[model samples]
Target: MPVDQIPIGTFSRITHLSQKALRLYDERGLLVPAARDICTGYRYYTFAQVERGIRIRHLLWLGFGLSEVEAILEARERGDAGTIREHFARRLAETEREIGRLHAIAEVLRTQDPLNGGFRMSITEPVIKDIPATRALSRRERGVYQEAIPRMIGEICAYVYPADGRQPAAKVTGPIMFICHDEEYRETDADIEVALPIAGSVNLDGTAIGVVTLPAGRFASVLHTGPYPGVGKAYERLFAYMNEHRLVPAGPSRELYLNDPAEVPEDELLTEVQFPVEDLPLSP
Candidate 1:
């Protein structure tokens, strides 16, 4: 029993670290005891180790892993500022990512509320409208529905607003539209076309965008005002109208984004969901 060595009990009381934790730290070589009685096999700590004990507890409280705490302690002992900074920087980034993930989860939970969720019944009535034919700069791709649509829109904007103040190649006449060519519901690998009508003379000489002349047709249309997920109700209404009026789909359906999503909140987004249709003859 050295005069400098304090029993584990006394050390635990002074440092506020549990005896079990002190023993675990000793086993991990994170903070070894100052001495051990050979006869009793009891551990004792020195006052010099108290600061390190408090530091280890504080680091653990900050959510640092045991391994990370050990590395940080060693770096502090070496007076290596850069190593300490690197560890903190990494932890900060991890915290930010965790925050973002939690926010996404919260949003999902919020949208599940029956009365206040993101969904709403269709407020606008379905109508049969004549959609005029027009030439559009379009890009077709196989991917997730409208997930990659923004990227396609950016590609078109880049050519229209062409790089570095160069003369514009085309004039955008209408809002962005996404055409769904699939006949049935699909989870992935969907056939889609993203297009923007252009009325003025245009040149897509070197651009990957191909010119598409959107066909004129009578479409059953419904304007949906809310998040894209709420558009399902519009489709529900459209199909019901079709069934009641004995109308059949003539061509693929399309979504016309009437306003810039970036400029409006999710609840204010305006999208016209349309399906080309033909009237069924009266049964004799």
Candidate 2:
């Protein structure tokens, strides 16, 4: 019972940290009590520990892990402002990325239809057409779907536009398109290819970037105009049409960007969704 030692309950009240959390922190070697009665095994922390306890709670509130909190505490003990700055800068970047992801999720939720309990239907009708074979420059990558698509497209455009002396691909045969190779919806590690149709070939180098031919085929297509997040509804409509018409998908799905997103408002962006299909006989 040292005069400087504070009982666990009193320390908990002072720091606003629950007894369970204090015990867990002790178990994790994050915070150790100043003394423990050998007979009763009751924990006691010093008055000075109250400041550390409060700091730990604040760090936890800021989404820092136990290890990170320990590191920050160690940096403070050493009076290393640089280390603290580095840790906080890294955390700020991570928080910004999380915020972006949450905004994207919110956008998707906003576009859902309450009646259908699904994404709002955007396209009323889809056209069936035969697409001609074409050659193009492409870049393929695997990453989070919504976040990765735009970045990959921008990288491809950056490389292609300047490599060709700022000239638009001769005749620019078709709109910029993305071939979705994944068979099912994926939140991460989606297989995507960004392609630009060129009337003539240009030399390009890179393992992930190259020239490739897009196969010609009959496709069931719909035009979706609005933010990209609402494109899911267009896919729902396309699949429904395919099921009703008894058509089987023959190849990967494709999305043709009809306008530059950088130039138009997100709500006004245009995209043409196409799914290659094979026709089956209608049932009597």
Candidate 3:
């Protein structure tokens, strides 16, 4: 009833925050009422609290949780710009990851077949073969799944094959292979290695590239002939085959690029997906 205090209804209208939310915030000690009527138990807010309420609403709209808003407000009260900047940077990165996940979900929906109640792509049996060990030059980088593989491959090729009439120092032995080190699907910071088998040793002292030798082993592999996004279907079949046959994986999985994306359409791109397998256990 005091002239200085505004009732909860009027405060909610002014701040654009629902009355229920204000009560919850008060209960959580995020924003306490400026005054409370002892007899009637009515909540009231002072004019000064109007700015704080509006700031909380704006932060909520910006996708910040109540705890995050509290931290930011506390930082602001302490005049700590560095903490505020750090919080904003972290929120930005989280938003980016969420966006990436949403995009991946959209891709799955677009590829699904409603009529058959299954995915549109079909997975075939993989060929089993023994692979020989080889030495190669490799470049490892942490990046997102789709964009990193092609970009790293281009960088390696540019280093090995220069356009200026200079002879190449190293001889490329076989198709480029991508070794996936992540145990599961990751939208960001996925560990990937791009390797090119080289016939001779090449100096990589000053660059990010290094020399690596791939161990010879038996592998189960399938030819994935389509866009990269749909290659998961091939992996599904390959893993299912391994599980059904009681074959255990021995090393990191690899993808041999049989054709260049720049030279062919996405649907025509060929990739040989290979998983190194341990030998079947001797019969008990």
Clashes of each: 0, 0, 0
Q: Which wins on TM-score, candidate 1 or candidate 2?
A: 2
Of candidates 2 and 1, the better by lDDT: 1
Q: Encode model 1's per-residue lDDT on 69-160: one tens digit a residue.
A: 99999999899999999999978866765675576456646765477344643448899999899789999988755355667878987888
Instruction: Tell me the lDDT of model 2 at 278.
Output: 97
Alpha-carbon RMSD of each model = 9.8, 4.9, 4.6
A best-first ranking of the candidates according to their TM-score comes to: 2, 3, 1
Question: Which regions of candidate 3 fall more than 4 Å away from where they truly are?
Answer: 23-29, 36-43, 65-67, 78-124, 136-178, 182-210, 257-265
> Model 1, residue 21: what's the lDDT?
89
Give the number of colliding residue pairs in candidate 3: 0
Candidate 3, 1-284: lDDT as tens digits: 67989999999999999999999999998889999999998899999999999999988888999999999999999999999999899788677767866775676577666753333444457889899998998989898765677678887887788778577758998899899998877888999999999987576666778888898999999987766667777887898889888898888899999888789965577878999997569799
Q: Which is the leading candidate under TM-score?
A: 2
Query: Which sections of candidate 1 miss by over 4 Å?
Result: 1-105, 111-117, 120-122, 281-284
> What TM-score would each prediction reach against the true structure?
0.60, 0.71, 0.68
Q: Lowest summed-lDDT stretch of 10 residues in model 2?
A: 115-124
